[model samples]
Target: MNAPYADPSVTAKTVSARISPIGGLDVLSRNEVARLRGASGSGLHALLRRCALAVLTSGNISDDPRAILEQYPDFDIQVLQQDRGMKIELSNAPAQAFVDGQIIRGINELLVAVVRDIVYVSTQLEQIGFDLDASAALTQSVFEILRNARILKPQVDPNLVVCWGGHSISREEYDYTKLVGYQLGLRGLDICTGCGPGAMKGPMKGATISHAKQRRRHNRYIGITEPGIIAAESPNPIVNHLVIMPDIEKRLEAFVRLGHGIIVFPGGVGTAEEILYLLGILLHPDNASTPFPLIFTGPRQSAAYFEQIDRFLRLSLGDEVARHYQIVVDNPETVARMMIKGLEKVRHNRLDTKDAFFFNWALQIPLEFQQPFRPTHEAMRALQIYHERPRHELAADLRRAFSGIVAGNVKEEGIQAIEQHGPFAIDGDADIMRALDKLLQAFVDQHRMKLPGGTAYVPCYRVLSA
Candidate 1:
């Protein structure tokens, strides 16, 4: 069947269908179902529609969240509460998610995930039943969210390798991520990512091939994302287990708590934000004894990008921070071997501390890293990024700065804010300002700030001369 309505602006075919629950998302409370079917205002229904559309349109190349919405303006979703279970109704949905009038099973499961996460977070979490004050409470909230999604495995060992990188990247960089992931998979490791395209998808794709070669069953390909990012960077098709966190801060924390190790690839400000957040948490004296493997690797041609990143880290956080990470360029096997060795260390540490293997209960994440950072104009201007503050504290604020830039580049609300008020104004110590400006300019020059297509890139934040 053809699309119900044609928009000259978007010629892509669309379809409408009703799908039953997949992966046990059929069970929902009546109140939850009502909220999902609420009026199309700022209620839970609106969030459900946006997230469900994002799942239906997985693998879309555009980074602008509004771009997809504009392409299929009439797309909508509704949840029907039945006597036995639930049903999802899609109107003007992306045709890509369907094959021969039937929704792809994986897409169906992800669509159910969209409904499950949105309803649970909006209804249960927003009611403040989970205390958000102390650091312990925040961490518990993250654990509960993952548990509700059925992601945390108590019996599993620490072998989930979280891959972090930008969705917008060069072909070489993306292929390199796959190579690293292939090596990791051959070593019997699972994969986790932000669940978007580019680097996030490459690793999982490579692992699928490797897992097939090894005849590995039940290989987990997990994708963790938040509402703000899913529409722009929809879950990559390779993700078998998808979890949508409440916010970016919780999403980042989830990555740290669940994964045994992390591999960084060529990326833009979002990747930078993740690195800063991780390093900041590790820098705390309480977490210094923990064993978390971190490796930065890319194609040989992308070595220069790592060099600049290493320089920025050294300058901003001091040379001692270098002790925490290893940079291995163009060596996927070596990266995997090092990860294996590091996981051994982590296993030993967990055993020594009597900590759970599934979650990093021993790692100390300060409140600075747990709290959400909204990238408002005022928040951006007020950040203090100088040497006067403790190194970890400074890293936390710097992570927020990069996070704001990420919001401006892709998220819908941030994009609109950038249009209303010019680029965010960021002024700090002169040395740090220069470093930040140089790093951001490199991203723009390399087409890392946005996907490589359509219009020219625009600066989202200004680095003033301090």
Candidate 2:
């Protein structure tokens, strides 16, 4: 894969290479080239540059948003409109992305995805008629984006499993995720993840060997990421299919809608946010009968992690919420067996309900889940995390709170906001706030909030439990 490794001794190195497309990114309009070449702040040129850099430094892990840019300050990319389709001209680009004056095949394919998605989103979407306000419209837009990316397949069985976990995790936990992934792969299930390091990358890595052993030719390693989080968690090397959604909300939606089942490994705030988001939607009365298989798993040593997670969920959402997921700790085979068994029910449900196998249209995702929640300071403080509302509603706001922490922890804008206005103030009912604080503290103690060996995490939000 020629994935970039962040060598601490790597002072500075750059490469200039003209890359031709390997995927379906053959042609680009004159306007598209101008858009990529344009220096205007309002144009797509800046976005292309940032995303291209991310692709070039795929496995070079760093939570510091500006670390990569600081390392290769002069990195640049341009789209040249050529007679033979199009060519990408790189200047002062990261040297690791290239080997012997040629870009890596996997990296180049991802680069093509970066170009393809950004351009398609620019031309086809920008006020092209997607009513983002309506839930159905938002879902339709997600559908369109996936369709354009060729993510949607017809007449396929339900086997794609969405694995969720933190980029920052322990070695044992990471290895455990791979074992579970390998087990699933042996049973012919493909993998999808947030597409970054740690748990996200481990499963795909393990599955590749199993798929090879089983002679599975068309195994898909899909990575779903958003621009805001991509800087912190760049797409891992194993991802053959990458889709960058417009926002985190859309990205989360893509995960739930696309996968037949989901497996959650031990993780931190971001993982908590994903858990809450899916649980909130599934708790909806309309989705009560949906046969979505959800599992929480990890190694034997990580048992306490799941215990804490289960306690938090029960405390926050109640005993009924536990029905939506099973806790399968330390047994990778059982986890796989349960998911495969559950998938059979999912297949039966989809067939009985007359729903498509590729996308889960039958699941009723409310407008609250679809709508984007910008984690501004005021928004954080304004979240109604108390128990006076419906469980699902509280879950939604709780998800937002954790999401805000994720932003502060890694996303550039979130970090900037914290530096400017101090930590976000989160006030809620006394018990809820305390429970929240406890869970967050556990994440910090376990080094789940950020990748271990980096800077110590400071509190990004003050929990006002009074």
Scored by Cα lDDT, where does model 2 land?
0.88
Candidate 2: residue pairs that collide: none
* Residue 261 lDDT, candidate 2, scale 0-100: 97
Give the per-residue lDDT of model 1 (tens digit) for 144-172. 78888888898777899999999999898
- Over 1-466, each residue of candidate 2 has an lDDT whose tens digit, in order, gives 1223343544457777677877858898877777778744456887788778888999987877778878877777888886766788887788788887679889999999988888888777875788888999999888888998898888889999999998888889989999999999999999999999998999999899899999999899999998888888888999999999988999999999999999999999999999999999999889988999999999999999899899888888888999999998799999999999999999999999999999999999989988988899999999998778899998999999999999999988999999999999998889888888998998999898887787778989899973
Off by over 4 Å in 2: 1-12, 39-41
Q: Per model, how many backbone clashes are there?
A: 0, 0
Clashing pairs in 1: none
Segments in model 1 whose C-alpha atoms lie over 4 Å from true places: 1-12, 39-42, 126-128
Q: Say which candidate scores most in lDDT.
A: 1
As a whole number from 0 to 100, the lDDT of residue 267 in candidate 2 is 90
